[model samples]
Target: MQSKLLAPYEIREMTFKNRVVMSPMCMYAVEKKDGIVTDFHFTHYGSRAVGQVGLIMLEATAVLPEGRISEQDLGIWSDDQIAGLKKLVAHLHKSGAKVGIQLAHAGRKAQVPGPIYSATKLAFSEKYQTPEALTIPQIETVVSAFQKAVKRAEAAGFDVIEIHAAHGYLVNQFLSPLVNRREDQYGGPIGNRYQFLNEIIEAVRSEWTKPLFVRISAEDYAQEGVHLEDYLMMSRWLRDQGVDLIDVSTGGVIPLEAYDVYPGYQVQYADRIRKKVGIATGAVGMITTGNQAEEILRNERADLVFIGRELLRDPYWVKTSAKLLNAEDQLEVPTPYQRGWR
Candidate 1:
């Protein structure tokens, strides 16, 4: 039987060979703290391309130095960083895998040295530093940073550009009502809260003509936090702005709550967004097996399945998954590994 998960999926001019995506996960391997790609990054990402992942998305890359999640996180804030990224993209392309990067700003969640910026002065927790509320001029600076980052991403030859608006990051801080207590233009009503992201998208779209994606924390898991209706509204705006897909993940907009965690736990959010918003979605979180991923595609739950830790555990996960679904013939095993792949 043929595998739906192995079918090619297209968005704009980019076509993915399969439904499997390497979900962006922070490696924290930049030893120089200069935000440049190191040898570890080449080996780490190249192995996955060799394993045949259709779309390999890089981890949260800072748009500003202070926006980093840590000193070791990747950065795309400078023109100097482009060559290394370009080389990485070229490496992946040689293996027939498309490349993507998540443009991010850690905001109040930043664990770096300097002060972080957010919609309000609220800190994520007692453990985190209290962030300075972004002034209007400062907000504009942040938007410009995203625009500059998009230009850098384009120069690096990325097939996809995903704005990291989820996980309680700078953009998420502006999106969630519970955290953004500002009564200014960037806060209060939903439209106002959306203004920050709206500006960033506009800036990014001006430079990025390829497939654009926005990762969102679908639910806040807090009673008064962002809910489905809020996300739907935001998603509709994203659609209007020409966003290609919504990478749906739940929680992480606030402190952890006792929510059930299991395989496919987040697929429901992705499915709902795809059906309700009439936009494509990528399902992620604990999705570990071939059957699980195949079901998501065959059932039309999501257009893509983003695998994280599982890919880290097995770089050849595509081959393994193909074997599991008895669809090994669908994947072109690398010439060097063909004998062992079977």
Candidate 2:
């Protein structure tokens, strides 16, 4: 029997070996002052590739120095960072997994030394300092930073470029009304709030021709924040901008909200966006097993399944799940691990 979870999925020119994608989880492993890929990243991602993950989305790499979530986050703000990233991409390719990088800006959540920037001047919490609101010219600079980062990602030979517009990041801050209090062109109505992201997608498209994805916080879990319906509207605009997929996740636009979270918690958002917006979607959050991933695809809820913490907990989860689902022959078990599988 065929399993949808183990089937190939194509977006543009890249064809993933299976529907399984290792979601970009921050490693914070950069040892040097410059955020370059260290040996740790090579081994960490390579092991997952060896485990037969169809796609590997690299961590949220900062597009600007001040945009880093923490001091040790990976960065692509300079050309010098390209070589190490190129090497990492090559290493993953050897394991037959398509590679991607999530370009991101931390916004008010950035815990760096200098000033933090956001759509509004509000602090995320009492512990965090108030962020400086970005001016119009500063906003243009942010778009340019993403454009330059896309060019570098192209030079790095990545198969996909995922714009990090979700999880209360810079783009998410601009999209959510609860945080974006500006009365200017960048704020006000939903269309106005989408201006920053629209510009980013346009900018990234100018440089990248391969598969493009945007990770979005579909449900803010707050009345004032974005909801699934809003994301459906946003996904339409994203489709217009040539975005290939929406990596659907929820509730990072503000502090954690009271929401029931079980396995496949956010899959419903993915299903809504895919069905209503008429675009492909990737289901994420709490998707831990192959059976759960297969059911999402079998029901036509989503096109891709993003496995996060589970992949970290077990790099070989895909292989184990393949066996559990009796689809072992469908996935490529590396030669050294074939004996164990039998």
Candidate 3:
């Protein structure tokens, strides 16, 4: 049987060689705390490209210094950072892989040495700092930061750009009713809460015409927390605003002691959003095997399968998957590795 998992997928003008996407995971590898790409990044991501992964979505890179989840997070807040990223993208492209970046802000979750900001003054937990609530003007500044980050990402030649609106980050904070307690235009009703992301999307669209993606936590796992119903509507809004895809992830909107965890756990949310909202979605979370990934694509559950820990455990996961699915003919093993694959 032809392998849908190994099939080419396209968005806008960029075409992925296969359906595998390297899910964005923070490496926290910037040695100088200057938020620039380093040798570690090159070595780490290069292996995945060499392994023939179709689209390599980079870790959450901060859009502002204070927005960093940690001081070591990569940054695109400055024009100075472009050269390093450009080289990285070129390196990946040389290996016949498309490159993407996640533009992010840590919000109240930021652990750096500065005053953190969020939609409210609440800390994530007792161990975290109480963030100062962002004033209306301050909110606009953060939006501008995301917009500027897009220009830098475009300069770096990224084939795709994903807004980091999930995992209890800055954008997620605004989206979650559990966190955003303000009574202003930026808060309250779901549409008002969505206003922040809407503006950021508009700003990014002005500078970027490439395929854009928005990552969202589809289930908050807390009562009255942002749920699937909320996301279904917001996802529609995202699609209407020209977002090419929704990267569906769950939890991290609020701290959770424990939750369900099994293979393909998050696929249902991706499936629901894709069917109900009529938009492309990427399924993530615990989807660790080739057969499982194939099932998702074959059943039309999600357009792409984002491999996280599995890819980290094996850089050549695509090759392993090809073998498992007996679809080695679909993969173009690098010339040097041709004998091994055969």
Tell me which of candidates 2 and 3 scores higher on TM-score: 3
- What does the lDDT read for residue 282 in candidate 1? 99
User: Deviation in angstroms for 50 in model 3?
Assistant: 0.6
Give the alpha-carbon lDDT of every model: 0.93, 0.94, 0.94
Q: Of the candidates numbered 1 and 3, which has the greater lDDT value?
A: 3
User: By the TM-score metric, which is better: model 1 or model 3?
Assistant: 3
In model 2, which regions exceed 4 Å deviation?
none
Instruction: Say which prediction, candidate 2 or candidate 3, comes out ahead on lDDT.
Output: 3
| Clashes found in each candidate (C-alpha, N, C closer than 3 A) | 0, 0, 0
Score every model by TM-score: 0.99, 0.98, 0.99
lDDT of 2 by residue, 262-283 (tens): 8888999999999998999999
In model 1, what is the error at residue 126, expressed in angstroms? 1.0
User: RMSD of each candidate?
Assistant: 0.9, 0.9, 0.7
Q: On residues 117-198, what C-alpha lDDT tens digit does candidate 3 reach at each position?
A: 9999989998889999999899989999998999899889999999999999999999999999989998899999999999
Error of 1 at 170 (Å): 0.7
Off by over 4 Å in 1: none
Scanning candidate 2 in windows of ten residues, the lowest lDDT window is 250-259
